[model samples]
Target chain A: MAKPKIATTSLAGCFGCHMSLLDIDERILELVELVEFDKSPVDDIKNFTGRCAIGLVEGGCCNEHNVDVLREFRRHCDILISVGDCATMGGIPALRNTVPLRECLDEAFVNGPSVHNPDGKYPDDPEIPLILDKVYPAHEVVKIDYFLPGCPPTADTLWEALVALLNDKPVELPYQLVKYD
Target chain B: MSQSVMFMIDGVQVEGRAGQSILEAAGEAGVYIPRLCYKEGLSPHGSCRVCTVMVNGRPMSACTSPISLGMIVENDSPRVAQLRRDLIEMLFVAGNHFCMFCEKSGDCELQALAYRFGITAPKYPYMFPKREVDASHPDIFIDRNRCILCGRCVRASKELDGKNVFQFVGRSAEKRIAVNGEALADTDAAVTDAAADACPVGAILKKGVGYVVPVGKREYDDKPIGSDIEAKRPAAGS
Candidate 1:
């Protein structure tokens, strides 16, 4: 059978989850044989968009750039996967969610340790993004078909989710991953 | 850890009016079934298999299992004895465990458990995983080599402590605990009493508390699980 077209993108995250995806070792080579990498931030495949079979979205929506990137993936993919803890439950970065947005911004920029001084003595870069009032799961904004929850979903979990989706089987998750509040 | 009005231990009638664990009964009865990774005032976590005992004739962590009425528990069965020995030997081989230099030598639960099971060396070839120490916190130093990854500290940090600071990274045998995405400062954020109160080993030692508690003087080998029970306790001062 022909390989399914897969695309991947990272938003306002540290990209740890994407790195974990690539950390599949020899199985990564196996994945290379199974699916066609269409447009991935890590794969350096830019502008390739032919109706993605599986579009893996990492990180939560944190800024304008992140929102726009997610919109693009939502527009293209057939099955959108909100991958990792960030996409699933906004992850630890979402701890910022509990606090006010202005306080967070002031803490990072205005009252920061002088290094992050947003004024930059004169003008801040226009392209620089701003943090949102709250960090949210990916599904809050866009439709998500499946979620792989973890701080960074383990490589086995990432592989398993993909294989299940490709073969139309149910994804099995360990109780440890979901049992905790 | 909530107080149970009624629970059983060893098929013999015993009062489990409080949410006491199987080990509590064993300890109260002066039974000396050995255990590592279980400390008083810390939450009961079934990490170190040294605490494994025959609950209904099957091996289970005596520290974590809550006592239910009429539950048959055996701490001295041959199977549990073998399992304890095997588990203690694994812990010894995994870490240097040089007791001579350790501060909590006489009072160490890990050492006591090993002694109870008569495990000096492991039957398997020694395979010590190399680890680094993190003393980022002024009060406490983390010896990664000593951690058995029972997740008592990690769970305490997230559930009891409310910091949700630490987490486990890697997979299976390669698994090790990490702090706030490997950033030490992340632990400073949401630490509740649960993490500190629930740590079963020296992995999460109290900062500036060693001098206060002294060596032979901590909560005895048996103390109730604190906040872990508060969730289930009634409105009373239980």
Candidate 2:
């Protein structure tokens, strides 16, 4: 009798998929009518203080904070959808899986030029978050109900998946979307 | 009109497994896709787009499409042929594909694919990315010019070997593969030899050549992988 409560959060992505979803423009608003936004960039609600029916996650688990976000998503939502390639296969960022964490940190913090934070002291400065050794897809750590999979999935594919869930049918992507055109 | 059907590729009737792409069916039926990025051991990256084929009527990458049981597929369509020529040429321009004076010259798949597709002249100018070679391993050498960004060696390091050694560091054309930040002088540290052996070009080299055949007896015998490369699927290592 009630519309489903849907929420979305991005952990470690360019947020390209969410913006691409906005590119759908009016349809994303149409999506708004069917699901209540709880904890999204579009909504101000911060903590998982209430129940949710569906949660859409749009990034891979790249660090400890990302891991915490995934666990919070799993706790609140009945079903979880990994909304992009980052959430599904760690996207292009997972390419960093080949190198050592120390090496990357050295480049980012010590050697590379952000200019102001050029010294290694900044990484050790307690304010900055710790970096993980490798980037991983969401499914590697959590139980994902479905995956929308694209660098950013097509709007129709996302729509079809939500509609399928509402209709109580199995929602798996067709080869076109899953295979990434 | 049935959602389920069977398709034929190159006169071979494959059972057409459900949820598989036409490329997979062709592979199962022993029909090769002649692609650079679709390795069985690694994740399918349709980036190279050399596996273009005609399904129904239009050209599409078989690596990404689901097989419709009654689908008609022409693996080596004129369009695919043209694209393969163009894509391989783009890869040549996109990086350094110097075949002559290279060790992997005779064995390189990119070169072999070019030879198979009859690419007599390169239609594009050299992109000349000019990235540095990562000779930072004891038994491996990564000549960036010859690197195609196929990510096979990258994947092989993470998935199979669990070493997590090869990764792309920058964005777009500036994208260069890195092995733990150090250049070749850091070879004394931990490096993966299996990942080195997985490169399809002279991009990664090891010792043990110059004895396969002597001069004069050295025959120019190159073959199309349109029917080969089924030899253990190259283990998904780039």
Candidate 3:
């Protein structure tokens, strides 16, 4: 029988969670033997080829594209796990939640001291994804099966949760595995 | 000498003085009753409700309720645990608690409680209310975003420091911690005051010194909150 497939993505994140997942080191060999990668940066798969057993989302929804990608993952995967502080609680991106969108855009594109914009206009193009008014956690956008709360949710945390889910067991993380920072 | 009172906590008999609260007696008996507003050496405010325990099947704040003779207390029951978890979750969502970057992440009682409860993320939606950061004070800062309004500072300032430098302002959702004067800098708050050290979250922090303790060496990193109190328990089979 074919092994269960896992999908992963980084939305509005710094890709630290993916780095931590890779931090599993030689265990990656064991993981590949247990499950197949689908629609993940791990295999450079741009899109889903088939349904996934689990979806590991690494960030929150900060733009229309993020929402679209998260919704796509929700539809394609049987189980969705938020795999970091960013995916679970919006992380550093949500710091802009208090600031007005206009002010943030102006400060970034129009008035920042380091910015060099001759036209003094915000980035507006048909191809560019529109930014959302506020960043939202993955669960706020789509139903999340589980949440691994950490800055990058240590490699052990991701590995343990995936192993438990793959074996149809409960994902009961020990005290050391769960951390916010 | 005060008369000794015996009560049953989680069906285990425990003895305390007649005037002791359930929380105080529980602490002495080596049963860690989690609390925030009720700090040792300070008067119990009973405001946080994290220490709510079942007193003869009725919910009461263990920090404020005195233990009567033959009283039955339930501290670690599933129902009470869930209640505490709910309260912690509400506190998280109600405040803009960015735990990832909080200076008091490891040492914070609020964060430690959340960690102890295994709360990956709060179940409720984030309020994300716009709050202020008062950096006006040269020696200290008040980040309202992380404040849980537990009133620890209020009690500490008035009862311990005798400064009355902090107090609650507004009502209901608008409620927040306010300095005695127009700003914290205008007030007589000093970094050495017990009020400065009383905050359970990152709301109140001393300036110039942060992240001093490394990640692994910080308080509540290897052990859970209330471990110190639980460590005081008598050895089993004694």
lDDT of each: 0.65, 0.69, 0.94
Model 1 residue A35 CA deviation in Å: 0.6
TM-score of 3: 0.97
TM-score of chain B of 2: 0.80
Q: What is the DockQ of each candidate?
A: 0.01, 0.01, 0.85
Residue B160 lDDT, candidate 3, scale 0-100: 87
TM-score of chain B of each: 0.69, 0.80, 0.98
lDDT tens digits, residue span B121-177, model 2: 345644444467665455556788678887777777777777767777888888867
Query: What is candidate 2's lDDT per residue for A114-136, written digit by digit as tens?
Result: 73563346445466556677886
RMSD of 3: 1.3
DockQ-derived CAPRI band for the predicted complex in model 3: high
- Model 1: DockQ against the native? 0.01
Instruction: Report, to 2 decimal places, the DockQ of model 3.
Output: 0.85
Worst 10 residues of 2 chain A by lDDT: A172-181
Identify the runs in model 1 with alpha carbons over 4 angstroms from their true place.
A116-130, A175-181, B1-205, B208-238
The TM-scores of all predictions, comma-separated, are 0.46, 0.49, 0.97
> In CAPRI terms, where does candidate 2 land?
incorrect
Candidate 3 per-residue lDDT over residues A78-118, each given as its tens digit: 99999999999899999999999999999999999999999
